[model samples]
Target: MLLPLVWMISASLMPLSEVIKVPPVWFAPDKYSLANYMEVWSRVGFSRYFFNSAFVAVTITILQLLTSAMAGFAFARYDFPGRNVIFLIILATMMIPFQVIMIPLFIMMARLKLVNTIWGLIVPSMVTAFGVFLMRQFMMGVPRPLLEAARIDGASEPYIFARIMLPLCKPALAALGIFAFLGSWDNFLWPLIIINSQKLWTLPIAMSRFTEQYIAQTHLQMAGASIMFVPILVVFLA
Candidate 1:
C-alpha cells in the first residue's frame, strides 16, 4: 500500500536516467534532487494550476460545510410539511451517478454563462447530497433535550445552532470537510468538461496536459503527481 507512494516520492526526486532504469533503484541519495520539482513549478506553470485547485477546492469545502450543516440541523431538529419526504428525496440524489447528470449540469452552467470560469467549477459543487446525508446522520445522534434545554433559557434557533449545535458537530464537520476537500481537489471530469482556457485549468487538468507534454520525462511526471498528492495527504492528516 505504501510502496506506490514511496515509489512516487522517490521517483519524483530522481533524475531522468535513474527513473527510467530497469529494476528501478529504490534508493539513490546522491542522484536525488529538486530539479524536477523546480521545472514543473516554473516551466509548466504549475503555480497557476495549484492556485486554481486550492482556491476552488477550499471554496467548495466551506460552502458544503455551511450548507450541509444548516440543512442537516433543520432536518434533524425541526419538523415541517413533507419533511421526511424531502429528506428522502435528498438521500435519493446520492444514489444517482454524477455521469447521469453531468450533461444537464454542464448545460445549466452554459446557460448561466459560467462555463470556462472558476465559478463554473465551484457553484455546482457548493452543495452535495452526501454531505447533507452525512451531517444529518451525525446530527441525529445529538440529544434533542439539550436543544430543548437551551430553548427553555430563551435561546434563539440561530443562537442554539451557532453556539451549541455547531460546537457539538465538530467531528461531523471534520469528516465532511475532509470528504469535500478531497473530492474537489481530485475532481477531474467536471473541470475538464467546463474549462477550456489554459489559465483556468486545475491541477488535475494541468497534470493531464503536463503528462502529454513530458511523456518521456517520467521524473517530471512523477514530480507533478507528487505535487498533486501533497494537498490530499495534508487534508488526510488534518
Candidate 2:
C-alpha cells in the first residue's frame, strides 16, 4: 500500500513523457521538479477550489456542532413529552439514504434560488442526524449530578451547556468535527450538481475537471490528486 502511494508521488514529479512511457517511470532521472504542481495550481484554479472547499467544510462543521450539541443536550437531559418519539424520528432519518432525497433537495434549492451557490452546499449539511446521534450518545455518559449541581448553583440551561457540557464533550466534538469536515471537503456529486460556476467548484469537482481537460497529462492529474488528498492524510495521521 505504501509502495503504490510513494510510486504515485514519484511519478507525479516526473516529466510528462516519463509519466507516459511504455513502462511507467517510477522516478525521474534528474532531481524532482515543481513543474507539474505549478501547472496544476496555475491552470486548474486549484487555489480557488481549495478555498471554496475549506469555507464550505468549516461552515458545515460549525453549524453541525452547535445544532447537534443543543439537540443532543435536550434529548439526553430533558424529559419532555414525546421525547422518545422525536429521537426515534431522528434516528429513522439517519437510516434514510441521501440518494433518496437528493432530487427533492436539488429542486427545493432551485426553487429557493440557492442552486449554484455556496449556500446550496453548506445549508443541507448544517443539520445531520448522525451528528445529533453521535453527540447524544456521548452526552448520555455525562453525570446528572454535575448538571443538577450546576442548576442548584443557579446556572441557566445555556450556562450549564456552554460551561459544563461542551467542555466535557471535547473529544467527541473533535471526532465529529473531523468527520463532518472530511465529508464536506471531499464531497463531489452534490457540489457538481449544485455548483455551475468555475469559481464555486470544490477540490473534487475541480480535480475532476482537471483530469478531463488534461487527460493525457497523467503527472499533472496525479499532482492535483495528491494536493486534494494531503489534508485528509494529515488529519488521519494526527
Number of the top-ranking candidate, with lDDT as the measure: 1
- Write model 1 residue lDDT over 1-238, tens digit each, in one string: 9999999999999998998899889879999899999999998899999999999999999999999999999999999999999999999998899999999999999999999999999999989988988889999999999999999999999999999999999999999999999999999999999999999999999999988988899999999999999999989997
By TM-score, how accurate is candidate 1?
0.98
lDDT of 2 at 5: 85
Question: What does candidate 2 score on TM?
Answer: 0.95
Model 1, residue pairs in steric clash:
none
Give a tens-digit lDDT track for model 2, residues 157-235: 9999999999999998999989998999999989988999999999999988888898888888888888888888886
Off by over 4 Å in 2: none
